[model samples]
Target: MIKNYDVIGDIHGHADALHRLLARLDYRERDGAHRHASRSVIFLGDFIDRGPEQVEVLRVVRAMAGAGTARAVMGNHEFNALGWATPDGAGGFLRSHSEKNEKQHAAFLAQIGEGSRGHHEALAWFASLPVWLDLGGLRIVHACWHAASQACLAATCLDSAGRFHGEGLRKAYRSGTPEHLAADVLLKGPEVRLPSGHSFRDKDGHTRHEARLRWWDREATTFRLAALGLEDRRSELLDDPVPAECRYEEAIPVMFGHYWLSGRPQLLSPTASCLDFSVAKGGVLTAYRWSGESVLSNDNLVWVAA
Candidate 1:
């Protein structure tokens, strides 16, 4: 069990917000010396893509990890980014997002130089990230634990092996390929199946095969979690306890990032929490400090204005 730690949500290349947030959290270099303390940062992943400062963010995080001030898990976006760096297919999400850092990407590629030690080192670092970290009773992952496959579980079960397996998973991040880049789809839940013989219609009365995922709004007259089935494309509201079949229950308090919670971080379930606040979109990057049984919010670490 880490004595005092802070769990941060996805930064998504938001270096400015990350810096601001870290300052608010009182994270500092130990005056040219290394020190172990009661506080450390646990990044929940998604440190790249969909934001402007991927390179800067990477450099800072790499430094922090080297200094033992912080640790990070592998987010799906990072996996996608690494996959794009490979020689195989178009790197999918990685390639598409490379536009944000075309120059840095090129420089990074050049430094690595094909078949050189730099190449191997870069890949090794990317590949060696952890998928999930168990801090005492708290668990940190990029996304929901329920969505994790047996292979993912196997890779993440032990700390040493988990880090290696996580690196391998990052290296294999490609969509619709044999390696399974769509881990989110696998973990989020099965595609909704339409009711038998029921035709699907949108609120606008248009027919569709897929239903949109639901957003939880406390102020809404009807506050509930729902899922859409493919056939009828209709949403069914769930009960308060939430069905055990929903894949929310696990062995520990799972904190993750990936899902954009509109503007606020979501305290989804007592066991599951999402911290991504879209910092790049002028939203806050949040953190929750966990003690024995209480989760404390350091709102001062919120980088963006409300």
Candidate 2:
């Protein structure tokens, strides 16, 4: 069985950073795909949207994944791309082509051209990615790793191999469905609603009524302490108690991305790590070299300048 892995963070179309990181990890590009003698890559998705090189990033990742050198999970951006391209059985798409949505996806569409063969192929590949991976020794997901949320997907959306099928894709995007909630929590991290009259503007200037929870923080009890990736606005969050359901109590080493973390790449806890250093936002592309250690370490974190 494979024991060594290079768990990578969100790419967000930064192919240069990705290439640099792979080289830094000693992976060589061979036969149009990067591979290591004994190590494999676990890509934490978000391979498209924002930044330049969207198609290039997909090409490299798809080649490697296709050649069995890497495994990947679907990020929210990939999911959104599928929704944007899929018909809703009415006149509109699952994800509308509103100005805001288009603006967010402009870079990818500019590169791949909506409705092109490349776009359809990319969407098909995205549909094939698992929402999460449990490798017995370790687990990987794009965001939060909640058992109940995964169970929801297993029941309504994911096939035995964890990919979404036709009816599953439809239900996964439908509002008020268990599959929808599962997709949201797994791909975009779990969130906790703020107290009435409490809210904050996100990085995109959108007002948010809920804060992304630090689900891995098993000791956190209050919202103020449980908020993730919003250190600047933590004071504005209510000191209200965090719901018990938001806690992550598992012991398996889980490596995930999508938090847009900053600073030197590091483990969130002994068994939890967020590899995303916001490469799409002029930050680093981080990875962790795992050698089958049950407890993760900061020393294993490796990254390249963006």
Candidate 3:
């Protein structure tokens, strides 16, 4: 079990902010003779894409993991960014961002084609990351572990072989058709559904017919926590619970990234916390420390400003 650690939100290539945040958290280079303490820093993924310093973020995290100072879960964006194939391939996360990331995209393509040791090593590292981690009475993931994925989440368990499977999913993502990964899994943030013929409700409870992905509608936003016992081809909107089927029998709080939390670097959900504060967009990259079962203890958290 991970004893005392800091769970950091999505960094998104904000190297400067990340450096500052790490310094504030008391993370330092270990002297060669002295072994570092047992403390760990858990990054909630999204180490690349949508920011200027993807390479820097990758280098730092790789160093930190090697030094045993940190561990990171796989974020969808990282999966997409690292899984880029041919430039002419169908639109994947990498393709979608390539327009804005000319230099990084070119560099990534060259590295992948060269099939050098560094490329292979980086892929191996990404492939080895876990989808979720349980620490300090808290369950951590890139996003929430709703009921539908509970079985997979439980089976994968930690940062072992299970992460390879997530990597496999990434490879599949590169080849599969658009929307193949499903909107709920590929996109960050919660999920909402409007019936084929129905409308989404506003904050004032006014409903309107709008055909958009679940993440686009703010007021009508819902969480897709689990899958119903229906065929995969079935497009019926199911009333699944938000943060569904998380029994919390262990009474452990959960920490996750993937959602921007309205561009604010703060914790949401009194029970399950989301720490992605859009640091790549000039916001803050946040972290929180937890000891016991309670999540509302401000005293238990440590925030490092960007």
- For 1-306, candidate 1 gives per-residue lDDT tens digits of 546667788887777887777777777656532234567778887776666666677777777777787888887665554655554544344345455445435444443354566556546666667766767777777765544443544543325546535434543444565335335442232233334454466533566544333322122222133443231322443234333433544546667776665655557655556777667566788887666454423432344442
Model 1, poorest ten-residue lDDT window? 214-223
Give candidate 1 misplaced runs (Cα > 4 Å): 31-36, 89-122, 147-160, 164-182, 185-224, 228-245, 294-303
lDDT for 56 (candidate 3): 71
Between prediction 2 and prediction 3, which has the larger lDDT?
Answer: 2
lDDT of 3 by residue, 212-278 (tens): 2222212222332232212242345544433313333224567777755545344444566778766
What RMSD does model 1 have? 7.0
For candidate 1, the per-residue lDDT at 287 reads 83
CA-lDDT, candidates in order = 0.57, 0.90, 0.57
Shift of residue 195 alpha carbon in model 3, Å: 4.4
| Prediction 1 global C-alpha lDDT | 0.57
Name model 3 segments beyond 4 Å from true.
31-38, 86-117, 153-160, 166-190, 195-250
| Root-mean-square deviation of every model | 7.0, 1.4, 8.1
